[model samples]
Target: MTERIYTAGLVVIGDEILSGRTHDKNIAQVASWLQVQGIRLSEVRVVPDVIERIVEAVNALREGYDYLFTTGGIGPTHDDITVDAVAEALGVPVVVHPQARAILEKYYADKPGGLTEARLRMARVPEGAELIPNRMSGAPGIKLGNIHLMAGVPHITAGMLDALTGTLEGGAPLLSETVGCWTPESEVADILRQVEQAHAKCQIGSYPFFREGRVGANFVVRSTDEGDLKSCVDSLCDGLATAGFDFTPGGI
Candidate 1:
C-alpha cells in the first residue's frame, strides 16, 4: 500500500496583487516551505480584495485540500477584510481574539499612535480560532481548523511559516534529482517517457532552455522515497548514456 500524501491549497487575497501594483511573492515562498513540512502545495488561487470573492475562494480551497492557507487583506486598512470574509465562509461569527488583542496592545504600547482603532482591527478573527505566532509584528496569524491565515508581507509570511515548522503532521519531504544535458527535449522525449513509465513512484519534469545559442533541457525526477528516487535517477542516467548523451549530475 502507498503512504498517504498530504496536500495544501493557497489563496492569495489582495487587490494589489490583481492590479499588478504589488508583485506576489508569497506563493513561491509558501510552496517551498510546505515541501519542507512534508506537504505538497497542490493548488493556488489569486482573488481580489472583494469580500464575496475572498469568501468564495476560501471555501473552495479549504474544502479541496487537506490544508488551506491565505495571505493578504489581513491588515488594518479599511479594505482589509480577510478575517471577516473567512469568518463568513467558515459559518462562524467574527470576534476579537483576546490574545491577539493583547499582543497588539503590547506591541504598540511603546510605538507612536499606540493601539489605535485601526490597528486593533488586526485582532479580529473567526470565533474558535487559534493564533499563529508572528514575532515580527504584534498581530498574529489566524488558524481555524485546517485554514491558516497569514500576512501578505513576504518576510512576515516567512516568520509565520517558521513558527509553523514541525507543527503540522505530514508525510516525508519530497526529494528531487536533476539531470542537465545539451540534448533537445524533443530528441530525448521517448527516453524520458520510458524511464518515467518504469518508475511508479517518481515523476519527471522536463524544462527546456536556450542559452549561449544552444538548446538544452533539465530533467527533474522527484519522489518521497530516497531509494526509489536514486534508482529512477540511475536508470535515467543509464538510458541517456546508452543513447550517447552526456549529462550533468545536479543541474546546469
Candidate 2:
C-alpha cells in the first residue's frame, strides 16, 4: 500500500524578518520539528506585519496543506496582530481563553508588572482554539483545527514544538543518509542523478562546500522507506567508487 504523505505549510509573520532586522529561524526549526513528526514542510511564506497580508497567507496556506503553522506577531506589542489576522482568516472572533488567562495570571502573579492588559494579550486566541504550552515564556502557542500559531523566538518555538510532540497525526518519518566526498559536486552530478533515477522512492540532493583549501560535496539521499534509502545510498557509493572518487561514510 502507498503511504499517505502528510504535508504542512509555514507562515512567517513579522516585519523584522522581511526588513532583515531579525533573521528568521522559525522556518528551519519548524521544518525540523515537522520532519520528526513525519510531516513534510511543503511550503513557506514570509509576510510583513500587516494584518491583511497575514490573513491572506494564513487562509491560503491553511487550505493548501494538511496543517498550517504561523510564527511571530503573537506578542504583547501593539504591532503584534497574528491572532487577530488568523481569527479574521478563519471568520471567527478573538477572545481571551480562560485557561490561557489563568496560566498567564499564575505565571506572572509574583513577577513585576503582574498580568497587565498588555501581558494578558498573549492569552487571546481565535475562538475555539486550544493552547500549546510554552515553557520559556508565560504565553502559550495557539492551535485551532489544523492551524498552529507559535512564537517567533527560536528557543520559545522549540519549547512549543516539544510540547506538541507525539500529538499530531502523520505518516512515516522521512529518513536520510549522507555521503561526503572531497571532490567538486559537478564531477559526481551524473552519478547522483543515475542513482536517484534507479531508486523510485528516493531523492538525492548534492550540496557543495569549499573548505580547507579544497572543494567537497555532500550527497544526501532521502526516502520514507529504509530499504529504498539504503539501496540508493549503496548505489551512489558504488558509482562513486567506480569513478575513483574518495568519499566519506558521513558528510564531509
Candidate 3:
C-alpha cells in the first residue's frame, strides 16, 4: 500500500525577529530546501523569546506534522532560550551532552579566547536528545522527539540542516506547471474557478505581471499527485486556448 505523506511545519523564536531588529531569511530558505526534497511547508510561526510561547508552538506543530523545525534562540547569548523551551515542551530537564561539548571544544581549540562558559552553554541539551552538527559554528544544535532545534544565524542553521537532511523523511514531491494569460485576472477568474473545481486536488494560483506595454497573468497549477497535476495543467491550457488568450507553456 502507498503511504500517506504530508507536510512539515516551522517555529522560529527570537525577540529580535518580533521586534523587527532582525529580518528572517531561514524560513524561506528551509521552505525551498524542503520543497526540493518532496516535503511541503504547511505552516510557519514566529514568536518573541518568551519560553511559554515557544513551548506552545512547538507542542502544537509537533502533533500536526511529520516533522517540526525550530530555528533561532539557540545561541549562548543571554536571551537565547530555545533549549529551555524545547525541554519544557518535551517535559524533560535540560543538561549538557558530553559529545556535543567535545565537538565544540575541538572546534574552538585553535582560537586563543574560545570556549568560554558562555560558549559552553551551547552544549546544553534536553535529556535524551541527539545533536545536530553545526559546521559553521562548533556549537551543535539539538534534536528531541520530532523537533529539530537549530541555530538562528542563516549560515549555522543551513549547515545544521545539511547535516541532518539524511535523517529526514520526505513526502511526495510537489509538481507545478504555469501558463501565462494575455487577459486580466478578472477576465480569467471564472475560468480559473472552473479549473479548480475540476482539479480539486491541485492548487491554482494566479500571478499577475506587467511588461513593456503588455499586462498578463500566470496561472500556476500545483499538486503532489503527478497525474492530477498534469491533467489540471492540460485542462487549464486548453481553456486558455479556447478563450484565445496568448499563453506561455512552462513547468515550475
- Over the stretch 1-252, how does candidate 3's per-residue lDDT look in tens digits? 664676789998888888899999999988987887777889999988899999999999999898899999888888999999889988999999999899878887898777889888899999999998887868888888778898889988889889977577777778888887766788889889999999888989999877777778888898888999989988888887898876788721
Q: How do the residues 1-252 of candidate 2 rate in per-residue lDDT, one tens digit apiece?
A: 889999999999988988899988899999999999999999999999899999999999999999999999889999999999999999999999999999999999999989999999999999999999999988999999999999999999999999999999999999999999999999999999899999999999999999989999999999999999988999999999999999997888
Look at candidate 3 and give me any clashing residue pairs.
none
- Give lDDT tens digits, candidate 1, residues 15-115: 88989999999999999999999999999999998999999998888999999999988889999999999999988999999999999999999999999
Off by over 4 Å in 3: 1-3, 209-215
Alpha-carbon runs more than 4 Å astray in model 1? none
Q: Please give the clash total of every predicted structure, in order.
A: 0, 0, 0
**Residue 35 local lDDT, model 1:** 94
Worst 10-residue lDDT window for candidate 3 reads 243-252
> What lDDT would each prediction earn against the true structure?
0.94, 0.95, 0.86
Give every collision pair in model 2: none
Task: State in Å the error of residue 124, model 2.
Answer: 1.0
Best by TM-score: 2
Worst 10 residues of 2 by lDDT: 15-24
Off by over 4 Å in 2: none
What are the TM-scores, per candidate, against the unseen true structure?
0.97, 0.98, 0.91
